[model samples]
Target chain A: MSGIQDFVVLTLVKAAPLIYAALAGVVCERAGILNIALEGQLTIGAFTAVAVSFATGNPVIGLLAGVVAGALVGLLLGVAATRFGVDQIVAGTGINLLALGGAAFGLTVVFGQPGASAEVSALGVPGERGLIVGAFVAALLLHLALYRTPWGLRTRASGENPRAVRSAGIDPRNVRLIATMLGGALAGLGGVYLSLGELDLYSDGMTAGRGFIALAAVIFGRWTPFGATGAALGFGALAALQFVLQRSGVPSELMQALPYLAALAALTGIAGRARAPQADGVPYTE
Target chain B: MIRGLAIGLALALFAAAAMLLAGANPLLGFWALFRGALGGVPQISETLVQTTALLFPSLAVAFAFRAGLFNIGAEGQLVIGGLVAGVIGARLETSGLIAIPLLLIAGSAGGAAWGAIAGVLRARFGGSEVIATLMLNIVAALLANYLVVGPLHSPGVAGPETAELPHSSWLPALLPGTRLTVALLIALALAFVLRWVFARTVFGYELRAVGDAPEAARRAGINLAKTAFVTMALSGAMAGLGGATIVTGVLHRFNVSLSPGYGFIAIAVALVGDLDPLRIIIASFAFGILQSGALSMQALAHVPKDVVSFVEGLAIVALAARRFVAGRKQMTALAPE
Candidate 1:
């Protein structure tokens, strides 16, 4: 039926951004850096994509710029955690605040407005469909790269035992820094999807905590690329169901709260007792 | 002391650069900021009110940090606290003497319950409090929105807020015609009490031991789970008390937007204060100036007040380096002394 097809299509569309962000989370946490600034990266990416598109009238170029901006933000977190030995949690929180505040400030500076930017050139419906497909492709590639490559082994070693990675003559900090940058790029693309792919404008809080939901997905999937992708798809389905159920009698707030509540329940080990990386958030100080 | 001065200078420079980007004169923005925060008695009183609102959450954050737990749910706790106070205060018709304490207790209990959820998760399941608290914060907001607008919506109210409390229940203002109230004194007294508790109490010793060296504390037979639960509950209580005061003394009703991310800002405050309760009062005051003066800076200097948050975020990153150094210094200080 068209209804079932529409629901499935809607689910993928909703899941695309979350899938990208969860993949980002999977990469970073596996590399031993807990990237709490995913929200900030998403915000900066969405904002920069809109700003660049507004100036250049090229959505593709804006997409590239957005990814670069996100990588820079991730580099900020990586340097703070790896080089400065700053607490990763604290630095992540700081970066979130900075990215959010900076984007709002950027809105005033670039668009001559606060709260949102004017409508800009955006990726067309075809581009959006491509992005949705690209999300699944990204998940597949990450799974292959993580499980099959030597680089993946090193990255996993860095998270499990950075000292061991160092014994193998690789600097775990560099590994973490690279992972974070890649993760940031993935998250940025997710933001670009939200701004350029889904909508033609950037508004404050438009990302609407999808980044955090991706965090939940990372956990629900037990930090595997494919697992996280699947979890993201599940959350996406929930969101689509929310839209469909809106006409019914269920409270929208309660529906909106289900993912968070599920996350909280997951904390109680309801999702199974799968363990995180030993050095997931530990700073690699030498 | 020199490091403190350097950080201050760096913040000033950052603010100036932001103003330049915003096409505003840095010097004029700075002047407006100060003048708005301290130009007159009224302005100063407003600054103190902001300071008072910030102090409670800052203290709560510091308390949890001292126990080696990240209580990022203070915002949620504060909201639940205020919601409980507002809902109860709306229905009660009693003397101020009886109503005030009862409402505040209810607020604290609400916050403690909210906090205890994360506490139990960590203490019993060995879960990360960070994730638990973060999820709870969003849930708290969604829950508050639902309660205020749906089932508990008070008649005659036009927006998503509870009914106003009776005049008798309103906190007696410290300065007549100003929002400042005895809540300031209460927060200040709490600071001193916490200072003493940290300095002298057995529980404080246990808490510091857990924070400074958790494995060693476990070896020393301290119950880590119990300590985690108690610390989180107490921390939530402090934040809840702050929420109650805002409802009783400042807003006179519970509005979901009563705090502009004060809970998150309190992390920066707690860090800048070096996790010391007494010093957080000073940090709260410093940030209070930013909170109160931002509006004037926006109105007069054409600088987006968001620059304050940008600077605060930068300050958090900059100050994180100092906390690392300070932590090392404490480690050395504890060496066989």
Candidate 2:
């Protein structure tokens, strides 16, 4: 039915940001970094995108700025985790808290508002087609780059056995650092999509646990790009169903909980079988 | 200790920079912050109220951290606990003397049940507590929102919250004309008890061994599964007690925004206290001062109260930076090449 087709199309559009974030998680985790700061990265990306778009009147420029902002945070996280020997989890938590507080401050300082920013120019494309297509393309490109390229092999090797990566005359540290940065950039694109393609403005705490859910997708998909993207799309469909369920006498708040419950179910169900990178979250001594 | 001092100084400097960016005089803002938190009886009482709220969650985090598990679900546990306490307080027709203890117990029970979900998943299914707990936090939030908005919605109430608890159910106020309640004393007593447990009990020794090295702990005849489950349950109980106190002692009703990320901030408090119970008391009070002072800072300096959050984030980052520097120094000492 055309109604079902419309529903599917709408769900895919809603899933673009989550797919991007899940792919980002796959990249970082594959490089042996467990980035819990995805939430912060997404928040900062959304804030910067809207701010730039509001000032420049160009959503594309805003999108680019968002990626840059996320990458910078990633660079900080990399330095902390790889160079400084901070626990990756702690460093990620610090980043998340920092981004959260900083975004709130920016909301007041930069935008002269408290809870949210004023609306910015919307992306030119309708129905979020641009972001939807971008998500599919990224999924395909990242999958190839991860599986079919030597650099991808090195990244995966670094996560599995950093000592082996070192013996192969490559610094696993640098690879992880670059991977985390790229991951942040991808996450930024997700945030940009939320602000420019999905909504016209940014609000406080707007990402609403999407980053954590994306991490769940990475786990459910066994840390593969295509699989993670598929999980994200599945979550997106569930999210869409929540709206539909609201019309059928279900409490909206209970419906709102379905996505999170599904994530937990997925994490628990697959946890026993899923294998994580060996060196994930372990600090490199050398 | 010296490293902690250095981190403190660095955090202060970072906060000053944040204040400067907010177009306020750093010195004036800092003075206002401290003054507002400690200037008078009312100010100190407000700080103590915050300290009381933070104490149990900090202990909860520290307890789980000692067992080498990160339990980030304290927020969810707290919410569930508070909701149960509220529901009990509303429905129970007992004397205040009987109702208060019952409500607290019921809250802890609710939180323990919620936490057991993660514990079971982690213990039996090998699920990462970090991921499981994080997902559950959102679910708990949604559940709380649903209950408050649908089943428990108070008639004629303007906000999304339950009806107030009977006056008899309220915890006795410790400070007259202030929000400070017997919760502070209760928290202090629990801290002393925890200190003794960590110092003298065999369970404490097992906990330490597990945290230090699980393989060695297992080899020494410790039951990893039992310890993991018990530790998580106890941790959740602490957070639950805190949430119950917040409802019965502080708010006297369940409100959705009762906590402003106290669960997450408690992690910093635990680490800053070095996971020591007595020291956590002091650390919680210090953070309590910062939290209570943040509002005044906004009113006086026109700085966003979120600046305090920035400062808290900066503290964690500063501690991480210190560790990184120390690690490099150790490496250099070892290699010297």
RMSD of each predicted structure: 3.1, 4.3
State the C-alpha lDDT per candidate: 0.88, 0.82
Residue-level lDDT tens digits of model 2 in A1-286: 9979878987897788899899989999999888888888898889999989998999889989999998888887888888877767667777888899988988888788889999889785663687789888999999999899999999898888899999999999999999899999989889888877889899998898889889988987889999899889988887788766766887876656666676677655644567777776666667
TM-score on B-chain, cand. 2: 0.93
> Which residue segments of model 1 deviate by more than 4 Å?
B322-337
How far does residue A93 in candidate 2 sit from its true spot (Å)? 2.2
Work out the iRMS of candidate 2: 3.5
lDDT for each residue of candidate 1 in A235-256, tens digit (9 for 90 to 100): 9999999889988989898987
Which numbered prediction scores highest in TM-score against the true structure? 1
Report backbone clashes per prediction.
0, 1
lDDT digits (tens) for residues B35-114 of candidate 1? 89988999999999999999998899889888777788888889888999998998899999999999889999988988
TM-score of candidate 1 against the unseen true structure:
0.97
User: For candidate 1, what is the DockQ?
Assistant: 0.63
